[model samples]
Each structure stands twice: as structure tokens, then as C-alpha cells.
Target: MRARLDAESRAAGFVSTGVCRPDAVPDIAAHLSTFVDAGRHGQMAWMAERMAWRGDPAALWPEARSVVMLAHSYAPQHDPLSDLDRREQGAISVYAQGRDYHDVVKKALKRVARWMVAEAGCEVKVFVDTAPVMEKPLAQAAGLGWQGKHTNLLSRKFGNWVFLGAIFTTLELEVDAPEAEHCGSCRKCLDICPTDAFPAPFQLDARRCISYLTIEHRGPVDADLRPALGNRIYGCDDCLAVCPWNKFAVEASDMRYHGPHRAPDLADLAQLDDAGFRARFSGSPIKRIGRDRMVRNVCYAIGNSGAAHLKPVVQDLCEDDDATVADAARWAVERL
Candidate 1:
């Protein structure tokens, strides 16, 4: 059953697959409590809201006997950090460069889940990031990879550029041995962070993280932190890009995830109204930030770019309906 499920997962485009008991993540609850108690999750209050479900998968679904974890690689074809030098362009994270992974990975998860139900005659539930499940620890427990010092899963086969999805089933499948940590003495992921978001190895302070500030964070970002944002207008991938394990990373198999969307021109992005923003990032994950938040991030990038040519573009947004956007535009104009 385990072998068949693995084969089905690979046939469905997932690059990695493994199984573990639903109760495999023994230390997750304690680790999560420590992280959240330290206020590391920042404004992601949702993490604190569903304490039981997020901390324990068994608690989430008691009927589940096993959890099958799957990983889909979305590694960049070129250097993910190369766009930081193009100050005039806005650096969007590699993950959001194409169609939203939730939609893509969810569809793939459903396909695999349906197959599991059909082949094994077992009940199943699929989850792809949106759920309260702690996928990293489950993935680690399932031998997909160890959670690296950056706190993201890194596999010898696929590195840190993979999207995780899971299938919980009533079938008692054999579990795989968990992957051991291979980070050794490497601190490259920790050192590369512009805002020093990591308090120590394998921990993150999301409030200072560029990805959180630009995406999940609401309202005005700290003026001091804004300068360090550089040209990254969306999510930041500094830690992921600098990881030594990425040497083994493969190019994304999904063609939709490849392209110039990796670095869009700040000028063009700054001019986007609500409708234009929706149309531009229609199927992309960047759309989730909405126009105001997206433009706010662009303004921060414009300010950091030091490109005088974009001053007028920022000025035009000075009176944006969203206070955050307006504040960001004013800040950009002052900086430019």
C-alpha cells in the first residue's frame, strides 16, 4: 500500500512522498508554543487561534491512521537572488512568480487523495497549506527532509523550493524513517537575512521578516526596517536562496512557475490600480496581498531602490485610499 501510494504520488507530479503516523510529530506542540509565546509569528494571529489543530494532527482528525506527505519542487531556473541587483525592478519571491501553489498543489492533492480512496478503499482528507496542519514537522517525520536552520524543509533530492501537501487516511500504511539533519555547521541561511529575523538557529521572528512585512503584515511597516527591504516588493527568499543545500535543487517542472514575473518593473507595478493589480496577478499568489498591500510593498521597494526616476510614480500614490499605501508612497517620495 505504501509503495503504491508513493508511485501514485510521483505519477501525479509530486517529486517527493513519504508516510508517517498521524501522531508522528511528537514535539510539535511544545515547539509551536515556544515560537508563538515568543511572539515570533508576528501578526499571523490565525496561528494562535487554532492551537489544538495546528499543534497536533491526531487532534485534527482522530480517525486518521496515517499521514502521507508530498513535496512538489518549484526551484528557480536562474539565481533567485540575481534580481536584487536590478534596483529598478521589484523582486517578487520565486514561489509567487507563477500560479498560486495552493490552487496548483490542492488540485494535485485531490487527485492523489481520490486515488488513495479508490485503490485502498480507505477514507481520506487532503490538505495543502491552508489547513491548520503543521506540514514541516510531518514532512520531516515522513523522511521528506529535515527542517533546516531557516526553519523550512530541505531535502537532499529537492532542496527548500518544494511545496508540501498531505493526505490523511484511515489505512495503516508503513511509515518511513525520518530524515536526519544535514545542516552541519552551515549558517549561510541565517546570515543572509537583511533584517536579522532569526533569533537563533532554526527559529524566526516573523515581525522582522521581509516576507511577513510585505505579505501578512498589515498597516505601516517600521521606517527603519523599510530601508532593508531593498527591491523585494513581495516575499523575500534570501535565506532559501543562500542555503548550501540548494546546490542539488532542480529547475521547476511546472512551466507556469517560470518567467519574468520574478522581477517586474517597479514603475509598472506602482501604476497598477485595484483592477489592474487583480488582472496582472490573476492566477498568482501575489494577488492575495490585494492592491493596497501590493502597492505598499512596491512603494517600500521604490524607496529602497534610490532611483529618482520612480519618484513621480510614488508621488502619484501619495493619496492612496489605504492609509498604509499612502504612508508608504509618502515615505518613498521622501526617500527618492
Candidate 2:
């Protein structure tokens, strides 16, 4: 079953797959502990509290003997960076431009897990960004890819376009050799960031990240970073899109991962009220951020849009009860 799944994954455009013992992650956890100790996670304090346990997968689940790391390719039909020059339009990350990946990836992992459990006779647990799993390191250990200088998992075949997920099981499976790092002397990901999110190579300062500020931070963006955000409404992919290795990636196989709905027009996005917002983002990850945060992001895009005509919409949002909404609205009005 394990061999079959690896073959299926490879045929589906996954560059690699490997079974690694849960213990394979202890060294990774120890290193990540150092990253947290150095205060690299910024305001995401959860990374600090789990310091002891986060460093080891065995500590995370004692019963798990093996972990199956999986990768799904989401190569964009066009260069995501190409739209950045259109300041009047928003540049949403390629992954978020489709159906929420949590739903899409998890469904695939579950199917694979069910097949494995039935054939191998063991308990199985699956995760795709919803748990305490150290996905990047585990993927590296599983030989799925190597950690790039930007600290994201990258592969020779897919480059940085793969989305990772994992399944941990009680059955001990054959493990594969870990991948070697291929980011020799490359600092492109660090240099291309508009907000200077990377403090140094391989270490990210989440607070300065446009993705963190626009999507995760629940308040007004730093006035200095607002202009750099341009019209990116949901999340920033400037760094990911610019990686030179992406040239090897093929276009996404899933039609849902393609087309304009994922990259909706910024002007249309700014007009969404609560109901409109929910309806527009029905099954995508953007819906999980709620109307307030989504609007907060939209207002930043409006400000960056230099679309003075949106002054009325910005003014109306000023009365929004959410402090984050009010603050962003004020910023948009000033920019307009």
C-alpha cells in the first residue's frame, strides 16, 4: 500500500514521497526550538509554549511509529508575480485563490490514509496544517523536498509550488533517505519581499510579513508597511512566486485550482458586505478570516489601489464596530 501510494503521488506530479519513523523529527524539533528561542516567530507565541514537545514528533504522539509525508502540486497557469505591477488590482497568493486548501488536501490525505489502514491494519491520523505537526521538516526528512533558504520546502521537480500534508500511523513502514538542501548561495526569496519579512536567510520575521499583517494580525497595519502591501488583499506570494526554481513546475492539474474566481477583481472585492463577502468566498480559505478581517484586507487594497472613487466605501467602513475594520477604514480614507 505504501509503495502504491508513492507511485500514485509521483504519477500525480508529486516529486517524491517517503515513510519516516515519527522519531525522524526530533532533531528538527530541537532546531525549531532554537528558532523559537531566538524569537523568530514574532507574535505567534504558540510556537514558544510547545518548545519541548514541538521539537520531537515522538513527543507529539507516542503511539505513532511512521509518518507518510505527501505533497500536492499547485503550479499556477501564469506567473503570480506578473500582476504585481497592476497596483490598482490585488495579487492574492496562488494557493488561496482557489477552494480552501485545507478542504482539498485533507480530503486527498484521508482517502490515502483509509487505503493504507485497510491494507496494513493500523490506526491512522492525518493532518494538513491543522495540527502541531512540523510539516516542512517532516517533509524534508521524508525526502519529499529540501528546506529552501526561505525555509519553505522546495523540490527539484516542483520547485516551491507544492503543498504538504501528512499521515501518521502505527505501522512501521520503510523509510527513505532525507533530501539534501539545494539553495546554495541563493537569497532571492529574502531579497524580493516587499515588507522585508525575512530577518536573515532561512529565518522569517512574521510581523513584518505582508501575509501575517494582512491576514493574521487583527489590527491596523503599520503605516510604513501599508504602501508596500500594494493591492494584495488576502496574502502575499511575492517571495514564493519569484523563486527561480518554479520554472520546472507544470500547470496545476485540478481545474478548481485554475481560472479567475480565485484571483477575483480587487474592485469587486472591496464592495462586499458581510453577506456578500460570505457568498463570494463560499468555500475558499478567505471565508475563514471572516468579513471584518477580509474587509480590513480589502481596505488596504483600496488604499493601495489609489482608487479615490472608493472614498465613500472607505467612509462607510469607518463606522464598523470592529476596531480592526475602523482602523483600516481610517487608513484607506487618508490614502484616498
C-alpha RMSD for every candidate? 1.0, 2.1
The lDDT leader among the candidates is 1
Best candidate (score: TM-score): 1
lDDT of 1: 0.91
Off by over 4 Å in 1: none
What candidate 2 gets wrong by more than 4 Å, as runs, is 10-15
How far residue 73's Cα lies from its native spot in candidate 1, in Å, is 0.5
Instruction: List lDDT for all candidates, in order.
Output: 0.91, 0.79
Clashes (N, CA, C under 3 Å) per candidate: 0, 2
- TM-score on alpha carbons, each prediction: 0.98, 0.92
Query: Lowest summed lDDT over 10 consecutive residues: which window, candidate 1?
Result: 251-260
